[model samples]
Target: MDWSTKRKLEYFGILVAAILLFVVLPFFIFIYKPPTCFDGKKNSDETGVDCGGSCRLLCRAEALDPILKWDPRIFRVSLGVYSLLAYVENPNVSAGVRSAPYIFRIYDKEGLLILERRGSTFIPRGKTFAVFDGNFSLEERIPAKATFEWGELVWSRTTVSGPEISITNKALMREETTPRVEATVENKSLEPIRDLELTALIFDSDGNAIASSRTFLEYLDKGGEAEVVFTWPQPFPTRAEVCAAPVDVTLVLDRSGSMDDLGANPPQPLTDVKNAAVYFVNLLHEKDQAAVVSFATEAASPIESVLGRNFEAVKRAIERIAIRETDIQHTNIADGLLKAKEELVSSRHASAASQVAILLTDGVATRPEKGGDPGYPETYAQQVANDMRQSRIALFTIGLGKNVNESFLRSIASSSEEFFLTPTAKELRGVYKKIAEKICTTRAAVIEIIPRIYPR
Candidate 1:
């Protein structure tokens, strides 16, 4: 009786299990759902809506910061019109933003806000791309400082790639007052390209970027080439003029006993000063001329004139200036200025286009009287500075260390910007470099943007 009952029960259980597997299992399979990226729900392993799990796009919080290589470059297009360019890099190989808000602010030399441009542009993925703005007009203000900043962006996975454009046969023509740049742009991509933006930057012989221009192309067929020209309304200074333009620069350095003080980080004030002076000499253009004058109680005589092309001679002259160890530790600024003036007027460089005097001192003017009765040395130096200005020679003054007279140095300089205060010898090289840059460059009158399009 037990065997027969057990067999019947087992057969009944098997029938029940088969019915559940075939019918009920199919009903549940048709009704249930799994998580997906496009479902608009925070399901699956996603950190945010449709991003940050296995999705290619990243959430805003997970994105890395954008890298700006340098400050935005502003070019003066005309009297009041300007052009701006910013180079930015996106580190994420897969992340990008279609558009990002940006602000370009222009400030005057005194740090006064002049104008600001607010705009948005496409931020390409991966590699560096340039953000450009043209024809920014300010009624009468001249910009001295320009800054560019980007607003928050939503990063997404992108398939956008740079257009395959190659530049060839680039030539800069300076025959006219307006300089022109000729270049051929080739499109190597399989598809036709349109509305391509191109920019050209003009650098001086010293590798200082002086001017920039931008142009656009309407269309380019695949494997086609088009010639484009960028011309400035105002002719660039001729290469001959740039190379031949004469500049007379005289460096007046203080070699007083206090100069031997261990003020610099390595405690080498005199050596640092010599190095800085040599660096300044090296920055001069080939046609420019330089002179060295050192003073303690009195100025050095028999001023040696060194051509900029003879950089080694100038550096040797600078290194030869030695600190005075005598009882007279007085800073005879008047003697130094007088000697510099004499050197400038006597040298053939008197006819130079720009004559500049750079006076660097570590202490106050102590000798009011070089030989006569006691007189105001500071006043005498100021008068000499005025006379030099009247002669069309610009004067720049650098006050080093804490004992220097800022007011006196400021009075000697042609303008506020011409006076540099360096509390330590470590900054002497940078100051000298700045002065050299100012002396060697000329301001461009106009920057022109010419756009030409060729049909592929």
Candidate 2:
């Protein structure tokens, strides 16, 4: 406990502390690492373990959700095999998912879940894509509806655009028997491309994806080309409407004096007839051609002599046909029939399109007098109707009001179903609507195979 002994002990302790601070502490500081985004720790201000807060990778809660761009599509490949396709969208501009887990559930007609398909797919950067699952056997269970679901996706920034390739010369053949698609794929990039994948989609006339198949080409040299083929083991169902054919129809209307016998301000039956004719013309398909023919003392193609696809022009022509005060008292049914027949026969698509003639009359045919009285107008009209049918033109005749001769109007039609008698002008619109719908429904069935190459 003397001063010399105490001083010596303190000196020794100070020497040891100085050595530790300079040597051991310096070594530890040199090996130390600051908190980072990829360090797999939450030391820094990161939201998750190693994500968010200045990291290229975002946390699950920070990333925006992917969108289901379209409803899932299901197609039967064979007896029990089905193909499922789900169109997806990544709204982020520079962020994407490398691989994401997803689920597909198929439901029966009773709304019971029948199948659950689990799979994983890589979502590319900055685009809408497709995730497809195929060759699923329902085993006699038919799917009434299919749903697509997915869990949290790990998103990170990526600008990689995979495999610069182009598709060309696509051809779909043997659609009625065995459907097969033949196409060529070529690499446009200077570097070699590997594992090129492609998906094929067949859309119907309504642009709905009906059938799908996927094909792959393992590798391609720089600027190299190869042929890719996709085939369907089963043919598509033909009962569904693939195409709706255009129709060529001529609307024949009577503008005789008795048409306005109800004596309204704008004329009862005549005004209603014009409105019904416009409604009927509007109901026709956008590609259908229509012509207007009206008859009072004489039949005339008022605005246009030729059939045209311009439905507005056809409506205008029908509206212009009026029983004006200057018009004389006569109904030339024969001329109306002949004018309509002429328009239909000379139309541009006479052979390809469905031909039809709708005749509306309010009184008996009493024009073309032989001795200044009235000729055999009824006989001429009947003969023209028969001739119209011989040209494969379906005829529909409408008798308006109580004054019309039902027997004469019926004779002008091809069959009893084509004849309609309306006791009041108010009922005429409904009759015209019925005929318009019939014309649209009876459009000849056409087959078409649409091929689309979706890029990934």
Candidate 3:
């Protein structure tokens, strides 16, 4: 071996060893990182990234169903303005670059498009980012099924990597379950199951299972409560509620020739009558019905027909009733009550609830055939009262001003407790609520009142 040849050979060998130790070894180390396979690449979070033979990132597709740490699945529609949420979750990425653009598609059955939304955000890694609330409208009308995806920025370019979700419609109402009646089968299960199939046999007050409503339980997570609601039109008896239910009330006001006289209150009979009638109507609930019947010589047609469901309606009806104008040739108490009763009776439908009539008269009854007093005319009043009682009607009588027969007015009332015998004109408004309150009180089938005895 020559000395020069041997030295050159040794240098070549050292060079080969250095290349393998530094360059080739570092390349192999980078290629075999923890997420990398034997091939060499960075694994994607959800979508499995395809490294594709010596690429830095092993991008197959983002991993689907990344364990959601802060995923609040149950949400309210009100939280989002339009309807898009940015979902971001990455354990390794920086807080700033953690969140990416997400495309949300709400679909219906038959793969119909309901809503499609896009949102970009800075998602915190490992933390669920659902803050983006963009207002969007749903195109399709579907009962429940919905799906969402997060990955690609565009709908067409969406890369399915984030959570694969089976979106469900949030509960329509918060209190879905109501307190069930007693004597029913009790569910002993502690874990309240929502969307559970259940069969219910409904019974009337008579204890006969008349009809049944099919429904499923909706689970509310907060209080561990479950509510099941169903729609079934059961054969409810003609619920004879006196005045609690929404009703059309007509106040028959007597404003005839006899009402012109100023009795205890030195205005006019018509003045007190108008004031009292106005006050009475105002005391009614907004859902209640109201009309003022001011009768004079020619009997003015209902000043205001059935009104008073909203503020505007009640205000307008009050304005009409309070109008100070009349033809005071004669008084017609019986006629006004009869007309009011007829109006109320005719306004109701076969399916409607009961109606009420409040008749206010200052003086006695007078007509073409009969004049002055007419012996109180209790017969006509009684007839109207009887008719009302039979038809499940409630009649409230108010003896306003002076020259009013308290006994006759009492006889006209469906019940003795409903007659309003007021001594003063100014107290008319207070009396109105008292009468209305009496009507609004729950009228049950039967009540057994036990008198309480006390020693003084």
- lDDT, each prediction: 0.77, 0.79, 0.50
TM-score to true structure, per model? 0.49, 0.58, 0.45
**Which residue pairs collide in model 1, if any?**
177-235, 178-235, 232-448
Model 2 Cα lDDT, one tens digit per residue, 264-336: 6788778888998898887776667888888888887442435888888778877777775774768988889
lDDT for model 1, please.
Answer: 0.77
lDDT of 1 by residue, 1-456 (tens): 699999999999999888889878888889877777777777778999977788765788888888987788777776778888776788887777767899999898899999889998766667676777888788788788889988888677766565677787777777366777888889888888877767676766554456677778888899999998886776543232233356888899898878878854333588888888888887787677888888888888775443345677878888888765558577889888888877777645647457888999988887757476354888788888888888888899999989998988998899999999998888988998888767766543222232222222
By lDDT: ranked, best first: 2, 1, 3
How many clashes does each candidate structure show, in the order listed? 3, 0, 21
* Cα lDDT of model 3 by residue, 116-168, tens digit: 66665433333333333333444335423334555642111222233211112
Clashes of 3: 21
lDDT over C-alpha atoms for residue 164 of model 2: 68
Top-scoring candidate (TM-score) = 2
After superposition, the stretches of candidate 2 with alpha carbons farther than 4 Å from their true spots are 1-22, 26-31, 40-48, 239-456
Q: Which of the two candidates, 2 or 3, achieves a greater TM-score against the reference?
A: 2
- Residue 88 of model 1, lDDT score: 77
